[model samples]
Target: MLKAPDHQVAGHQARDGSLGPLVDGSGHFYKPLQNLDRGSKELAFYTSFNSMNGIPPRIRRFFPSFHGSETFQASDGSGLLPHLVLEDLVFGRKNPSIMDVKIGSRTWYPGVSDDYIQKCFTKDMKTTSMSLGFRLSGLQVYGSEESGYWKPSKKAVQSFTVEDVRLALRKFVSSDVGWASDKDTLPDCSLATRIYGGPSGVLAQLIELKEWFEDQTIFHFNSCSVLVLYEKESALRGKTHGAAVKLVDFAHVLDGNGIIDHNFLGGLCSLIKFISGIVAEANKALHGLESSADGLELH
Candidate 1:
């Protein structure tokens, strides 16, 4: 049966008076189509992307495996609607922590309606996107089955200052019990380093994606999000924490033809810097902890 996705971090949701994304137990996600122009553009992008040749497998891995589209009974009781059938990124994961970071300071592309551009401009100015080149669209961290997920409100996310954004990043990788609090607390850097600093970590993967964006000229992604996921339970238990990064939401993708995607590239570089800083900080903190333990043992 198709049901509301349990781990959706951000976007138009059922509570927002719109049909939200759904998931089937068989490892597929169903996103209800948006307005005509946006949905058609997204469909076209995926259809083209899936069929294109010569795209490197490493770069392609950064995108969700597109399985085409299908009609589904909307979870909101709306009639049957055509939905994009995508690989469910969180399938089989227990206590998953997910984050959606929308890249780009300007979400609207040239040639969009003036009113639409203004709308996007206003939103960009109000959120950290204008300054940070990216904004935390939303995130959900598993606290416990009893406590449920720790999700900041949309209003709270929009109101995040630079420090709050840093803390939010730290909180995502933290296995601490006090993670749900709004205040800043130093995280145990082991989990952060393990999940974001190692060879296959988010930092490494994002740098790889940045390299691809630096040279590619096939498409310009506007309002696209980088979705990050890791298993919180596994991280806490010292198990293999399945961490992943993928690009999603192509409603505003534009043909690059021969031009480079500077907008997306700039935002990606900014995100890379943030993740890199976290990794460095985590490493320093971990080294300090080890040294302190050694000193105590000597005493």
Candidate 2:
């Protein structure tokens, strides 16, 4: 969803297929020197401050500064926040910059020599398909010793349903990214996280706005590059009784698998708006319908 420059995220379409930085699930969009020597002190040193532009300061304080900042555009009518910029995006007063810090223990892309996590993508490339369902629930990182499957931990992955998906995704992301939400108040923290670096309490809150276009939707993260989500408006007449899952195509979005599409960006902006409408309607539907128990435990 990143738009053209001065405000948009800086990205390069790598020949191999990634979007640039560490390679996407597909080997194409490669992050520069993402693979540094293993156990390298320098890599640890830099991550302490590198923002990657979105890492919260509390977390970022644990890493190093980024080499430079980059910009990406916000949605329409974003006004003052129209452009989201990585810190030091314009830090060129011939400043010493992150690069000159002297990587005494190593170079860029630390932990290079260690055997790569070696993701066994389906294709010759290293990408696979995953379902990104409603509510962003239960989303967890799973790896296979043999690249055979995305075996979700049994205790973690449960029956796949709209509510199930939403709850899991909400919990998984909130915990990893450090956000929280109400039990039934699925706020879109994925977007909220973008507006990072504010007070911790505020930054960790979700917009809870699922107000994009109507209809529940499902996203197919086939590959890291091309993400596709689909939801039908309504069935014409002859369609099957069982509701059909729809598909939206976005080829080569990140690698050969992602699609940072028009709808994608729009969805992020409109989610908050949509959720507001849902909450309003739910309240009207019944008293005490809203639940606030769904959240990541702050251990």
- Which candidate achieves the best lDDT against the true structure? 1
Stretches > 4 Å off in candidate 1: 15-17, 144-147, 182-184, 288-299
Question: Each prediction's Cα lDDT score?
Answer: 0.82, 0.24
By TM-score, who's the top model here? 1
Candidate 2, residues 37-95: lDDT per residue as tens digits?
Answer: 32132233234324245444443332213343232222232222211122222122111
* CA error at residue 223 for candidate 2, angstroms: 6.9
TM-scores for candidates 1 onward, in order: 0.92, 0.22
Query: TM-score for model 1?
Result: 0.92
Kindly list the per-residue Cα lDDT of model 1 for residues 1-299, writing each as its tens digit.
76777778788775444688888888998888886688878989999999999899999999999999998677677788888889988899887889999999889888989999999999889888889889999998776567668898988898887777888888787767465764445555457777887778788888888888888899999999999999877877778888889999999999898888888888888888777776766666667654433212211
